[model samples]
Structures are given as structure tokens and as C-alpha cells.
Target: MAALGWMVLALVFLDEVLAAVAAGVWGSHAGGWPLAVLAPVVVVAVWWAFASPRARWGGPVVRRVVKVLVFGLASVGLWVAGHHGWALALLVFSVVVNGLAQLPSIRGLVAEQERPPAS
Candidate 1:
């Protein structure tokens, strides 16, 4: 069970990286080059500022909200970029994986390894 939980936890990071990729894809389609480069930078910045586990701000609740917002935006970006199937898949997978990661057994495993960031 813990192994499965850890895998799901790892998937969360992969999903986050894919979010940045989706943003880049959308930006590439929206503009020639600048946006393609800029979009993922913005996404990374937002994630680092609010969602990253070591971020200086935000408690657990805020962290969850930021994750949802980031994932939601990524899904929308994928859909707007004409990758509807990928968009839906990302959204569903993110939601399910994230929910699984929140289970007490899994959450405890993670919390034990790292102290929570500031609120």
C-alpha cells in the first residue's frame, strides 16, 4: 500500500511537469516563440511560489488550493491547444492521484520525511 502511495506521490510531480509542458504547447500555438518560452516559465514560477513543498508561504490548505489552480489551468491550456484528450486525461489523473496522495497512510509517510512549510 505504501509503495503504491509513493508511486502516486511521484506521479504528482510528473503531472506538474506536464502542466508546464501543456502551458508551453498552448503558448507555442498562441504565438510564434516568445510565449512558448514564457508560458512554462510562468507556470514554474507559480508552482514554486505557491505549490512547491519547500515554498516559504502557504500551509497545507493553501498548498492544495494552489495545486488545484495550477492543474486546472494546465487542463484548460491543453484543451485550448486542441489536445482535448490529453487535457481530460491529465485532469482525471491529477485529481485521482492527488486524492490518493492525501490518504492518511501516504500523507504520514510524506510528512515524516519533511516538515511542513510556513502558513
Candidate 2:
């Protein structure tokens, strides 16, 4: 159940990131369709490279920093796109959920999830 909740939260956060990037890029130019598509592609590429579990980057601190940076960008982008309610919700929910994730019990579960299953 906890793992499922984590997966759902991860998907929600990813969607929020994509939506925010698309919204920002869509408004950055007069004809934004192309840029909107390109923007998300770039963002996703960078995120996968730096933040994903299989990321090229090393160290837990770096991953945590990247996650925070991406979430911050997403929140700001949502605000720029005039989705004030969503922006606020994203920020608040991220704070609460991330805080909960820091609890000792949840932390152990997260560490376990990061480990590979025995073959």
C-alpha cells in the first residue's frame, strides 16, 4: 500500500512537472506549439539524467537537490501560466508529502525500495 502510494505520488509529480514546463514554453513565444513540445522534451531529458534513480549523477544529496529544484521550477512555471490554484496546491502538497517521507519508518521503506530485488 505504501509503495503504491509512493508510485502514485511520483506520477502526480511527474505530470505536474511536464504540465508546468509545457505551459511555460507555450507562452514564451507568439507561436508556441513547437516550443511547448520541445520544452518538455528538454526538461524530461534533464530530469531523467540528473534526478532519476538510474541517473548519471552520484550521491543522495545531489538527487535530493535536483528534485527540489525541479519542483521549484514546476511551481513557478504553473504560476506563470496563470494556474494560481494549481501552483499553490503543488507547493503545499509537495511540502507535506516530502515532509512525511522524511519520517524514520517511511525513510526505511524508501531505502528498501531503492535496493534491487534478489535474483
Best by TM-score: 1
Q: How many backbone clashes does every candidate have? A: 0, 0
Tell me the deviation in Å of residue 82 in model 1.
Answer: 0.9
Model 1 TM-score, all chains together: 0.90
Residues 19-110, candidate 1, lDDT per residue (tens digit)? Answer: 89988988998895899999999989988988888877867888888899989988998899899999999999899888888789988878
Best by lDDT: 1
Q: Clashes in model 2: which pairs?
A: none
Which ten-residue region of model 2 has the weakest summed lDDT?
Answer: 22-31
